[model samples]
Every structure is written in C-alpha cells, then in structure tokens.
Target chain A: MFAPRTNRLAVLARDWLRRAVPRSVRVEWVRLRRLPRWILEAPLMARARVEDPRRDYPICLAWHESPLQRGLFEGETELERGKAINVAIAASRLDGVRVDRFQVLSYHHLVGRPSRRRGFAPGLELHAGEPAVGIGGGCCQVSNMLYLLALRGGMKIVERHRHALDLFPDRARSIPFGLGATVFYNAADLRFENPLPFPVLLRFDVRDGVLRGELRAPEPPDFRVEVYQEGHRFAREPDGWIRENWIRRRFSDLEGNELRDELVAHNRCRVCYEPTSTQTDEESRAAGPR
Target chain B: MLRALVKGAGLVAVARVPGGAAAYRRLTRDVLGTQRGHVEKLRRVVPGYVEIWRQTLERPLEGARIWIHEAGWTAYWPAVCYRLSGRAGAVTNCEGRIHDQYLSRAIAGAIATEIPNDLNDPRRIRRLRALLWARQSDELFRTLEGTLHERCVPTNLPLADASRDLCHSGGVLEHYRPDELAAFARECRRVLKPGAIASHVLDHRDHLWHADKAYPFLGHLALAEPLYQLLHGHRRSLSYHNRLSPEEVVALFEREGFRCLALRRLVLPERIYLDADEAARRGAPGLSRRYLAPRHRAISEADLRTAAAHYLFQKS
Candidate 1:
C-alpha cells in the first residue's frame, strides 16, 4: 500500500523543514522530550536483570569489529569521532559481561543511561528518524557489534531496534547494509537471551578506532554459527528509496557438516541520502514508478 | 584571477612544444622548487617548524612514531628535527612523489653545513660538526635509514593500523579536494591509535599571491567556480587550491571522526579588511560578496580573512 510520488514530496518538505530550524535547537528539544520516558523506564528494566559476573576458562566463539568512523554525507556534521568516544564508554560496560541460560541481557541494563555524569560525550545519533547530536550518541555502534556477535554465537535475540533511515553513503562498508542495530536507552534497545546451557561472555573493546566485540564460552561449542545475507537490493518505493536484505543464519557442526539453515532477519530502511548516479540509473531502468 | 588565467595558458602552450611532457614536468619541478624552497629553505625553516610543534604539543616529542604526509624530496623537516632535538623515535615520510636517492643525500649534505651553530644543544651541535668533518658522505642517509621509513603511495598508507602516534602535515590540507580530504581523514583515523593526535598547518590565502603581486591574497574566492576549476584543476599541475574556509577544513576532518583539540588562527595584518564592505570603507579592492560562490558568499567576514591556521586534532 504505497502512494505514488508521495515519497519525493514528503522528502522535499522534510528537507525544507530541517533547513528552516537550527539543528542544535531541534536536538535539545528532542532530548528534553525523551527525558520523561527515560526516567520511567529505568526501574522497569531493572526488574528482570540477571547478574552473571562469574568468569570461567574462556573459549572464544564469535568475534566482530566495526569502524568507529565512516565517510559522511554532505551537509552532515562531523560527530563520528565523538561517536567513537561514546562507543568506547558504552562498550567498556559490555566487556566481560556474561549471559546465563534463559537470562535476558538488556543493553541499557548494562550500559545504563549514557549521561554526561557517566562520562558520555556528544556524538552523532538518530532521534525520531532524524540524525542529531546528543549525549551518548555513538552507543549504537556497541549494540550493533554486540548484535552481530550474539547472532554468530547462536544466541536468541529477545529485542532489537533498527533505524528507519539509512543516513550515510557506503564508502568502505564491509558488511551488508541494514545489518546494524540502533539503540536509544530503554525505549530502543538490543536484548539477547542465552538459549544454550553454557554461559556466553561478551567482550568488547575500542581498539585502534574500531569497536571490537567477542563472544566467549567456558567450553568449545559443538556447532559453529554463520550468517549470510540474501536478496540484498534497493527499491524506489512511494515513501522513498528503501534498502532491504535477508539475514540468514546457518548452523554447522564442528567437523564442517551443515546442521540447519534458517532466516534470521529481514531488514528494510528508507535511504536518506540520494543514491549515486549508477544506482539511480539502474533503479530508473527497472522501476515501475518514478 | 588574471595571473591564474595566464599561468594556465602558459602551461597549455608549454605542452605543445617538442618533448613538452618532459619540459612541463621540469617546469612543475621548478615551480615546486621555488615555491617550496626545496632544501636550501629547509635548513632555515626546520628549526622554527620544530619549535612551533614543541609549543603546540606542550611536551617533548621524543619516541613518538610520526607519519608525515607529503614529505617532499628531502623530507628534511623531520630529518633535521630527528638530528637536532633527538625527539622523534621514528619518522615515516609518506609522499606521492618517488624518492630520489642522489638528491636526498646531496640535500642532507648541504643542510648539514647550514645548521645553526648558535643552537642550545651541545650534543646536537657536536653531531652536526661530526657530520661536517666526515663530509656527510652518506652518513646522514645511513643514520636516517635506521629510524626513517619513506614510502611513496598515492592514496592508501603503507603503515599498519594504530602504528603511528602522530600524523602531521604542513601547508598540505588546502591542496586536497573535499572528497580526497575526507578519505585521508578516514585513513588518519584508521592508522592513529585512539587518543593520538594529528597536527596540520593550513594556508588559506591564495597561492597565486606568493609569486605574483598582481593577484590579491583573497582573489581566488572572487572567481566563479567553473572559471576557477578551468584554470586550476588537476590537469594544471600547479598549486590547485580547494578554497575551503578554516572552519570547513576543521569540519571535514571532524566528519571523519577527528576531534579538534586546538585551532590557532593567524590573520595577516594586510588582509584585515574582512570583506568587500570593510574594503570599500577603506577604499581598497577586497573580496566581494557578489563574486563569491553561493557557499562562500554566506561565510562570515571573519572566516573569509583567515590567512593561516594550525590545527591540533585528536583521534577519538
């Protein structure tokens, strides 16, 4: 159910509104409005928390690293470096944390509120579908890496959040688009539960300007998990150009025999920046609606 | 603008001559030689350069692995700094130009004789005297080889990730386009360890004013984008300026995840007339609002007149 030409008109109107107002004003306003919800959700999240600080002889399972900085789109401010600081602050809280069997590990529960008093810095963050700079902005990078680690380690995702808008052009993207998980404290979070009997330790570090995360266990796993992206494509929809992909998870035995294959996530996000000429030309040729 | 038009035309004419490619290459070399003061100017300027870095860093630079962008033929800035202060632990000169063996040694030899004897450090002075006594016969290059790593790369850096503690450059930022600068900033973030710093010296004034007195210091800002590109694009092989304001320069790196620590600006006394309005009051031909591109047109007069700046940025 898409209305033709509506996407382009809405985009133009949104852009006009954005230019009319100052970004700092808009960001401060949004932060002020989100404060009440953030305060109320703090105790609600503490109700189901599980503390698993017991460490065992570690067996590393899955590891992933994402760069803290990426090439920015035109007119966008340079908040990525600030984001790196935020990521480090948030990632340190996640490091060495272990999730026990049937225990739900909420991202906000561990990282807490990314408040200035907690040493979080101003960084690029998306608020209400618009990119803005706010306190504890780049914490999503930590959640994104943790999500990837959880998926590859065969953990069950309890709750996750994805961005509605893809904000940047892919300059040196290693993973498929729409793979990152966005987090905004208690309202939007990444939560995963340990399905296996053994505890899974989460290790994170901001090493060499990359957010590195590793999933570890007490003993070697009999099965190895792998993730593959399928049917990755961009489409011109009524609202805007949208990027979509299917994340497929495969379970393999230690001896390399395939055990099971299953669909993990189907992601779709509206493209914020204009597609490059080649993408535009390709989309124009195959599209039903302009 | 006229000077750029003439220079551009002359370059085109020179290309039409026999063996013109070689001739034009030599001309570009001469341009760099005169403008950059290749080696002779190095001995005089190296000490001041080191002092500026010292003041800005507020600490000793000893044992810091430094990656210098666009270290020219001699790479003598770091070379002399290494020899004199003994501060740098290692130096890697990343340049787009191929390293010249004979020229480097010769330049090192010549710079050795010109080393100021009034220097404070007796050990450094003794080292210089030893070089002169030995006739500098490849001793400098051999010593530098032990600590200095020079590699010619067009885009990507050859160093390992998080290997360098400091990434620095002088008079180089304006030469890169916005996209190229964005890529370079990303590379800097990738190579430098977290909390490491990048120090850059930028000259925002028009380069044409260096040689030609006819061109105003802010004349480049007055030209139309198309006309400016036509005269000074990459094919010109001259000093092509991207004409970014100091704020824009800082923002470009910041966008690539660099946090600005210190920005020291220098506005020359002569260019005090911020924009055309101030210039009109003074009855001088100044940068006009009408002539500037729409992007440049909106810039504040304070930003328009910034002649140079030293930026100290830290990797997050």
Candidate 2:
C-alpha cells in the first residue's frame, strides 16, 4: 500500500543506487544480510551424502526441465553461461538425495552460500524489477524448479519467498507467471518436508543443454497432484501497476477422484515494464498476461 | 526402423514428464480395474503365521503369553496373535510409537473378511471373526489395546521381567544396526521368562533389490563403507540394512546371554558362487570383492550370499 508518487520515487532511487554501487560491493552487502540467518540455521540444515543411486527407485512423482541456456535476450550469453555453471554446481550437491518421511530439505542448507570465491560467476539477478549482474544471480531458477517439484510431489512447503517484482516478459514461458520462488541464501530459503509414508528422492541432471529435476519415490505414489492458477488479475494501484494471482494445487487419487484442493500461494508483484492491457480505472479486471 | 526407435525414445521421454508415473498407475489400476496392491500377497502370508508359530512352539498357540517387539505401524504380529489364540492368550505389543487405530482396524477387517481356510478350526475362526466384527462398534479400539506394563527402567519394552513366555518378530532385526542389535537382545532377555524362547526372521540381502528387480542382490556390499553408512545409516532411512551375516547376528545375540538354538540361512542358488573372483568370471555382477567395502570384503562368500536367516534362541 504505497502512494503512486512515492513508489515512483522509490523506483528511481533503486535505479540510481544500482548504477552507483559496484557489483562486488552489492554482493558483499547481500552476503552480510544473510550472515546472521546462516549462522543460526547451520545446525538445522539437511545435507546430501555421497551414495550410489538405489536400483529399485520409487516411481517418480514429478519431473520438470528447462533449457539450460536459452540466451533469449541480447547480451545474455555470458550471464547464461555463468548461470549454467552455478546450476551445475548446485545440482551436484542435490542430485540423488533421499528425503525420508518427516524430513525437511532446505535449499540453502544443501546448496550453501553461492559466492564468487566458491566459483559462482557473474549472472543476471533482478533487484527491484531491474536486472543486474551479481554473483550466484541465476540460482533462482534452481530454486524455482525445486519449489514446483515439491508442490507436485505433495510435499509440505515449510518456507518459500515470492519475487516482489516481475522483471521480464514471457518469451516462451512454459510455467505460469509468478509461479516461481525467489531464494536469497539462508534468509529466504526454499524448504519442504516429505509427508508421504514412503521416502522421496530428489534427482537433478544438467546435460545436453537441459536442466532436469525429478521427485522420485521407491514405489508409485497413490495420488496425483495438479497445480494451476486462479483469479489472475492485473490492477492499476495507487502505488503502481501490479499483477496478482492465486496459485492452487489439487490432489486426486489414482482413480481420478478428488482428494483435496489447496491454495499454494497468493502472489502479487509490481510490474517494471508497461503491461499491454493496463486498466485506466481503479477496478481490478480478470485478464490474461500479454 | 529408425522411425520406431525415435517413437520409442519419444515415449520414454513423455513417461518422464511430471505426473506421468502417477497417471500411468491410475490408467492401469483404476481404468483397467486391476488389483495391484499388496493385499493379495498379504492374504497369502497371513495363514503362514499360524504355521510358523506352531513350528516354533511345538504345540498349539493357545494360552501362550507373547511379547512382540516393534510390531510396526500395521500391528501385523498382534493381528496374527489374535487370530490364532483369540481370548485364550494376550500379547504385549511393544513399539517405539503408538500404533494407528484406523490402519490396525483396516487390517483386522481384511483378516476377518477372509479367514484363510488353512486355519482349519471353524470354532476359532468364528470367535475371532465375531470379536473383530465387534471392534467397529467400540469407540476405543480394543483389538490390540491393553494396560502397558514397563518394569525395566529405560528399556524400550514395557513389561515385567520374566512375565512373558515368548518373544518374536519377523523381518525386524535388519533394521537395527549391529550396535543396536546388542541393546535389543539385552532388552529381550529381561522381558521373557527364564528358559523362554525367542524367534526372529532377519533379512541380510540388499533391500533395494527387492523393490528394484534390476539391482543386484549384493549391490549394497560393493559400495564404500562410508558412503553406504552416510546414505542409509540414519534411522529414518527406509532401505536401512545392517548387512550382517547370519553368523554375526547369532554371535551378537550369544554375547547378550541368549543361546542360539537354530540359525537357518536361506541362500539363492543363482547368487551362490565359490569366490568373488569366480563369481565375477561367471559374469555375476556386484560380487567383486575389490569393490566391496573393506569390512564386507572380509566376510566369507557363503555368508555374503545369505539372503535371509531365521533364528530360534533361548534365554540362558
């Protein structure tokens, strides 16, 4: 609930600061913000151990994949390469991990802090609806995939953060807008618990220009999960133009009988660029994204 | 031919899509109306429980006080005890956590619906069925509910010392680590009457192979010790296995003041070989000693191949 004038001023200020500060200094500042939470959550972290994959893996509950390096926008080649490197590093730590029933998988705990010293390169990160180059910037894609995997796997999401700003237009977006999670180290962690009676495996593979993730189990799961968006709307607010959507999940038995439909998240984010169909009136309208 | 290969690959890719496995199971199980659960398999095993008890006791199971350790969520042992002994004897169902009444009732309903014909006694079946039928009317489930008695301080079992005539479990020991087995054995000794009998079935093979048919039976033995321990050493692991040989398990019990009366090891013929090198020469995968963890490599080939063991012991 911000005034439109104040929101404009805040946006201008953020843009000015982004240009004034060096990327290294900004990276250090972000790390500093995360330090306290990192120290506090150190003992509660779950880590993956080095073990050969089991032969009889449970049937996969869900699987998702995205192009490893799309390089859709001009001058994104270097950032895309850095992002792939960061993702590969994180995937090695997560692939073939088994989360037993009642066990929680913490994204930051498993992936650790992604810093330049740890071989993470300069990747594109969005700050206040504007893209900038920063260390470990593109790891958000990994967190996004993990969040969706947990949702489809029927896991209980313990903690998650939604991006406050919509940075880019969908060129060839497969998933819904604002459906992804934004994680910032230990502070904004992506955590989910396996609520099933059987243990679930988190398998990630980055190969042949595809980053694939799967939630697998030792046996076929009895229920099926479907995630969809509801009540999607674009509103012109006193602060600025914003998009909102209710993301929901439905669970059904293998027989196609509905078990439960639950609200996963309600996302509302400020739009950085001009939306094609912007409402001049104050009333909210149910409209699809352009 | 190339088109067919491409089609096959495309199908495989589609099968890996999100929600594909569940969709496939639904299509086959629900649409096709197939009974794919373990219900049929469990029905076959339920009758054998009485035979196992008779063999161990060398007499009828009637009027025998039984102590079952770690009956798990299903309360399978208590169900079997009720079916065999009815009101003649009582069972002390000891476990780390409380049993789920709904699941226990479901099991009882399944058992009573089709009392296996092999049980042979119409009188026992009639009484057991009637009692199980009455469980639905009771607000509190009385099928396995009783006063919990704990005499030993801090022990997992809640029963008086020398109060129980027999202690038994099936497929429960391998879940305990080697160190844990010693502690469990000590607890068993304190609960049972002097010279009382204890019988247990322990699985020694890699549990992963049972679920995944393609996995080698001894594949777990080939891993580096630290890696295996890191993965399945945690108590919450579903595929947790101590990987102890039949002899090692017996020795551990003997150390805990129990005399091992019988150690029956069941080995698979195809899994048996003269030595690791010989097995590898015969193209027996996962039998390579060079890849085995150091501790497992020290075990005899015969012992390593033992898939399971049934032990009968007496308190010394």
Which one wins on TM-score? 2
Clashes of 1: 2
**Candidate 2 structure quality by residue, lDDT tens digits, B17-88:** 676544644443333323223334445544544455566664356656776654333334455555555532
CA displacement after TM-score superposition, residue B126 of candidate 2 (Å):
30
Query: What TM-score against the true fold does each predicted structure earn?
Result: 0.42, 0.44
Among residues 3 or more apart in sequence or in different chains, the pairs in candidate 1 whose N, CA or C atoms overlap within 3 Å are A78-B255, A81-B257
Give each candidate's fraction of reference contacts reproduced. Answer: 0.00, 0.00
lDDT of 1 by residue, A194-284 (tens): 6554767887888888778888888887677778777766778998888777787777667886655656677778898778878666534
Report clash pairs, candidate 2. A56-B212, A58-A217, A58-A218, A58-A219, B149-B158
Please list the C-alpha lDDT of all candidates, in the order they appear. 0.65, 0.65
TM-score of chain B of each: 0.73, 0.67
DockQ of 1: 0.00
lDDT of 1: 0.65
